[model samples]
Target chain A: MGEKIMVKGTEAIGEAAIRAGCKVYFGYPITPQSELTEYMSRRMPQEGRVFLQAESEVATVNMMYGASSVGVRVMTSTSSPGFSLMQEGISYMANARLPAVFVDVVRGGPGLGDIQPSQGDYFQVVKGGGHGDYRLPVYSPSSLQEAVELTIHAFDVADKYRTPVVIFADGMLGQMMEPVEFPDPVDPSTLPSKDDWALTGARGRKARYVTSFDIDPYKLEQMNLVLQETYKKIEAEEKKWEEFMTDDAEIIFVAHGTVGRIVKSTVKMAREKGIKAGLFRPISLYPFPYERLAELAEKVDIVMTVEMSAGQMLEDVKLAVMGRAETPFYGRLAGVIPTPAEILEAMMKEIRR
Target chain B: MSEQVKDAILLASMPKALNGKEFTYCPGCHHGIVHRLVAELIDEFGLREKTLLVAPVGCSVFAYEFFDVDGTVAPHGRALAVATGMKRAKPEMFVLTYQGDGDLAAIGTAETIHAANRGERVTTVFINNAVYGMTGGQMAPTTLLGMKTTTSPYGRDPKREGYPIHMMEIMRALPGVAYAERVKVSRPQDVPKAKMAIKKAFYAQLLDVGFGIVEVLSTCPTNWGMDPVEASRWLEENMVKEFPLGVYVDKVTEVMKEKGVK
Candidate 1:
């Protein structure tokens, strides 16, 4: 354990990336997540690293592609609209199999909706947002401490799979401050060498080339199959979820990120009223813990999903439950956050039915 | 006669910096000429093992296959932004971008301007052929006001479409630009001058001064509806008037003098 220091969620992610040996950061300023870019601008020079404010989000993501092509750890931070602009580059990086990390401090959106926190990007992040067959590992953290830890872990996953990783935080998490104890900085020199695939001037070896383009349809299909295999392996090994007081509960609430923390309070309230409720939180949104959730659904009578969107995750909850339990959904839409009392009331209605 | 002719000295050959792969360009396309010039400069600088090329999405999309160095193809018009990242990540290595007019001036104008303004230590080779060649002859940002193409079948009119863009003029105005020049390879006599401009652009990056660019007024015979010789003549007569050939900016020599080197 290292010394605990107070930090905002966005700044903590910045420090965590630096500690994880991120060598380059290219980003454009947007609301709620601008602090991370500002933090990198001030800290990267001190650490002898590269930090550039790109002309726009479109340019920022391509810069990430360039840095990652050379086999270096690179990252960027953005809000919803900015994240939308990055979809094209993300598709390119995924096709090229470049390892990189991105932190999307999601705000309300259909188009420039609001700067307040919302999980409205659930569909865009969990599913393939760009124009292709690809999946990015998404980690959603409920608190500032977990955000710091996951930011470092996301880098490891990106390198292990050689694909882009997303830290799917919301605006509330970006603004909130918490005491976080960071791990020791990973010395970049000590990290495993990427010389085999990285473009390191091609000295003493054959020249290397990296690209996502193949005019031939048959060859492109083969490339996509390889990506599919990687995604399957990740699904098998990386599914993560948390359960609280579900051992003897008759009802369970499924939620993630900020909503998951709120449901924990709802579980306590339901338990006090002798309703026998518990909480199930998913940490990895892409490689969703479907199998485990199905098992829990078999044991419980009712599975309720709560979210900050109009029940985007509910579709996944329903798929996982698959009629094993009676499924119901409760949500607050368009930047509105639900309270524990309101969630508890919603759970009571389901029980009464 | 047999003894003297048997030991003749070779004057020129292919550059070692280029892989032996045959180019996919059409006959009389100036891409082949510009590619050779870039490769020659790479060999002269002994930077073959220390170079990274950011290929753009045009006829030169397969540029990585032609260059005997580490490289990647960026999305259309995003080459300069990608090169900026590559150079910043590996400052010890030489980085360059090869882009056509549509990719550089039309789609990627912001990336090109901001990268030059920021003084990113990377070189760019801009090919101004006045039309998009890969997707057929479409009207380009640099297309002449009276030129006709597949998209602009009725010769370009300033009332409907704007006048041709002069990228060299834009490059010269940027404070961070270390070297900017416009050159053409239409005539055999102009080849050496084109090579010199490209060599100076390479030095701009090697000397760690600032951004460098050389716009080559090239021709696309197939799209221009002219034979190879006629296309060359057309480039010399028309493109030369719209894009004057000369050094627009030359900070490389000043920096070289400051460093006390010739």
Candidate 2:
């Protein structure tokens, strides 16, 4: 209920977390996400909470793990390469089923990827980028408002699933300024109690064991089975997506993160040209809305997957459609942010196909 | 040996798991014995539930499985970082890191030095068994001169690779360490002394007495191509001469002495 003030997506996410009652901010200053960490560096100390510029990305995630283990709302933000460095710790947190927010502002490449924007980490984020048979609820936001909302939802989903949650963004979304409004600050007291798992100074209870240990081989396997079942429940219950005009579109534009925002403008231009084009944005990357995509595939003739990498999400789009519709792809690689015109160009190609 | 002498030995005998479990150390390897001693102390002190053991990745990647209580497997040489996180997060909880010479002195050198330098109220259980045992007994920073291992098959040349690091001297240099002692668990007679050093390290974490390390001169019989008996003897002769057994820093009662709100 207020006029919009311009803010970078990264800063907006940090401010949103602070408003959402996050107590600890642990991060290493990497490109793109540096704005978020800088915001925390200035604000967190004043708020009388903990803010640590950790030794490394690995240490940063571990710090988030430590703080999260004790029931404090904590988060760590980084980019693609830094997120790669954090995979082991992220896997560790996933195994422990710790609820903490991780923001991966994607950049390009296999190593020390470029500091500029890219959506190369879509597969990594959705597939539980760590070395474990585990999954975290990953949210891909299109705009500054979506970034804040998705980040808040990421924390909630993390707590609900008792697993790590990721707010997957790109450098463009992180650096670009836009207006945003936070829903409401969650009261720590009102939040769902994690008494069973959290190692807080709560009332009488046996030492809440937070470990990935089941001594017996059969028992460990059974534990893994149980985790898998829980993941299934998440996939079934928490799939969120947004559709613009999939009702009678011959061609659909499937994209996410900042690329999704660009896709929207392309769809509008395609509609002006009398071409049937629609936008499908996957808000949750994991527990991916495949069922919905398959249903929509029946209605569309061609589905064009647009991403900032050499066609990573294209494979997922194909899987989601499962060959019901002819799925094609377009990509902008290595720190290249796809413009609306570029996406429109891709959409025209999709319409012709 | 009379009944009273036998009873004295029985009372001194370590319990299981403090006898810590299933160490993958080679024969003549004193790490197993020393690890057992740490476990025994933890068992005796009833610290199984309260203690957070930080096991580094060198030879102890799966140590979390052996440790009964909450055990975190830290990255190579990053046991200090993991322990620091645990200690800072749970200020009231006991945090101790079990590290090897290679892990602490090599890649993780900075973390080990900084944690000690900062007096992070974390205890380090430094196992200074002259050579790296897991990766085919290669020369460690603490490897004694002329000690033949995989890396130094032609004997450790002081001219090329410098002399062995004196950890006791290094520990003494750091102001954070409340206690740093070089002990060898090669002999049955010396196991108790090694346990005492380990116990002090554990207690230092319990009492918030800053960084404490117990450097145990372990023997690896397999690497030495000797039986357990000979390796123990080798440790006494060659190892003890290089890393002379003694305390580098001792302020076990510093917490009790300090007149301030912790």
Candidate 1's residue-wise lDDT over B30-71, tens digit each? Answer: 999899989988987899999999999999998888999999
**Once superposed on the true structure, which residue ranges of model 1 sit more than 4 Å away at CA?**
B1-11, B260-262
Q: Residues A1-353, candidate 2, lDDT per residue (tens digit)?
A: 34577888888999888877788887888887888999999988888877777777866776676667666677889999899888887887787778889999888887876788898887788887777689888888888888887788877888888888888888888878888876767777888886666655322433234555544789878767877988999988999899988787878889987788888888888888888888889988887888889888988778889888998878879998988888888888998877888788876666665
Full-model lDDT for every candidate: 0.92, 0.77
> Largest TM-score belongs to which candidate?
1
Clashes of 1: 0
**For candidate 1, lDDT tens digit of each residue in A1-353?**
69999999889999999999999999999998999899999999999999999999999999999999998999999999999999999999999999999999988888989988899899988986898999999999999889888999999999999999999999889998899999999977777778888888979999988888888999999989999999999999988888989999899999999889989999999889988888999999989999999999999989999999998989999999999999999998878889999999898888888
Interface root-mean-square deviation of model 1 in angstroms is 0.7
lDDT: worst 10-residue window of model 2 chain A: A200-209
- lDDT, candidate 2, B1-262, per-residue tens: 9999975875676553442345665656666676667777776777666666667766655565566655556656767766666566567766667888999888777777767776777777777777777777888898878877889988899998899987678879998888889888766788888878877776666676778888888766766678988877877878888788988888775654573422
User: Native contacts retained per candidate?
Assistant: 0.75, 0.11
Give all TM-scores, in the order shown. 0.97, 0.85
Tell me which residue pairs clash in candidate 2. Answer: B17-B20, B18-B36, B18-B39, B18-B40, B19-B36, B20-B36, B28-B219, B28-B221
